[model samples]
Target: MFCLHFLVTSLPFNELKLGRRKYSERMYAERAKPLAQYTTEELYARFCFGRDNIKYIADLVRPKLQHKTKRSHVLSVEEQCLIVLRFYASGTFYQVVGDNMGVDKSTVTNVVKAVLVELASLVNEFVSFPKDDQMAHSINVQLVANADLIITNCVVKWPGSVHYAHILRESALYRKLRSNRPNGIILGDSAYPLLSWLMTRFPVANTPEQAGFNSAHCKTRCAIEHLNGVLKRRFACLNYLRVEPKVACNIILACIVLHNIATRRNVPLDDIYDGPEPDEMQPGQPPMFAPNEGQTGRVIRDAIVRHYFRLMT
Candidate 1:
């Protein structure tokens, strides 16, 4: 009885504050608002993206964000999305993100990679290149996505200087596209092998006619080029690519997801880039015998060239 009384009396826990300090909680990651505080514009500025985008990302990953303990909530879906976006937009260190997020560096790392994996699974949902009669124009709408936002089936994760053409050759999406549109054309640069359905540029513009074709081709494919530029410029991480290829690929896709959101909302990434840069990532002519345009491709190219020539004249 004496020992029990002594233990009870010695415990001064009741006099002390119960939980973690409020200042400490909020100094790092506890700054998350109740989603009622910021207007749409303010949210965009703070998160460096859009409200709809957060929801979209939330829908994709929220289900997967199970608690490690399953007894309490450590990080909300909205917080995870915000943390991921902050990392993408700032391109800063994980420790820095953790400080901003009020969590440990390990938490930041896990959150980013978890969100990235979820986003990567959604690549098919947001990225695509539709074919003729593929419901692109049909009411079905899933057949092909809009040309301006096409993701070209899947993204390539570089593993020590492997060529993209090899990836393209191995892609199930490319094969499916080829089979679906045997006579149709897809735009690509020298890094990709040419097929009858794939349009690449002339290596040289020795003649006026060749120059005209290349120019028209460039103009036609400029949307994709501008997209690449916009994505790189907005996220700022793609400019140098410091992360592993897997993470890098997911980051690129996530940025694209937000870019499409920004486009749909007509909300620019601030007063900065109105559109893509003038000097785009031009498509090139792949090396010979690796796979290239055939006679059918030439006919289609000739027709497009003639049409443009007529417009010029």
Candidate 2:
């Protein structure tokens, strides 16, 4: 053993290439400088937020993301925020994102998880629903937005195969609506069962009044559709989340929080290509939970047709 150790030590460091090699220092590339140099437009294009906005986000998440590690290569709060944002904006592989940021894929994965957990914790503070995943694998995101395209409420828990109406029926909002009822009618498409507080389109608009009601309902309800479009546009990663179902759910919620922030701040969307949200359900399908359709909903629909849509048409 002594002779073997002596021989091993006698070999020059340059010639000891075959066995377990020791690195003198842990190598850490300068990760933040390149991103720091990006212009506002360039930053927006890549991170989906300008320098100022990114800084603001860094400040917001710093409390949760800031670690007390003594390691010299530890990521700063700002750098950590950028890494996750880049992942969300690009929706590319972790290795791809890490390469752009001068970090390893493992680092990218860690930072993404930490940041998503932090942001997703803020869902209640930012999002307001009128109330309150996975296989080959996808989750249905149910969103409610106002005219300004700001998402007021969102549900991001159901599996991809779950029926839309089933999702609604199972929501806290549904129970609240059932118990207290909405002050104003909420418009939903044909897939949703007609409820007293939630109006779905008529099956056959035989009369001019019913046709006009359908037209008005469609125009107004399109706000939610536009919200979905802008959301996926701003965070293209959400278009096709590559993570497992649970992690993917957190990513979706995190994106929703960021989406609201961007929308409220009026961050420009021109940098990202905008498109319509793809509709998964076929049109003209029978309404879900038809047996459970509320009688009061039919009365309200007829009243709206007689009182409002009749005058407009």
What is the clash count for each candidate, in the order shown? 4, 0
Cα deviation of 307, candidate 1, in Å? 4.9
Name the Cα RMSD for model 1.
8.9
Worst 10 residues of 2 by lDDT: 132-141
Candidate 1, residues 36-60: lDDT per residue as tens digits? 5778777666666667767766776
Error of 1 at 263 (Å): 4.0
User: Best by TM-score, which number?
Assistant: 2
Q: How big is the positional error of residue 294 in model 2, measured in Å on the Cα after superposition? A: 1.9
Model 2 CA deviation exceeding 4 Å by range: 1-23, 130-141, 271-293, 311-313
Question: Candidate 1: TM-score?
Answer: 0.71
Write candidate 2's Cα lDDT for 1-313 as tens digits: 0000111325556658766565444445656553558888999989999888888888888888888898776788888989899999998998888888888878888899999999998888777754321111011137766666666667888897777778888888777668876556677776677777788778789998899987777667656767777777888898998888999989999998898889888889963434334334544544554454578789988998888877542
Off by over 4 Å in 1: 1-30, 34-37, 66-73, 134-147, 190-194, 206-209, 258-267, 270-295, 307-313
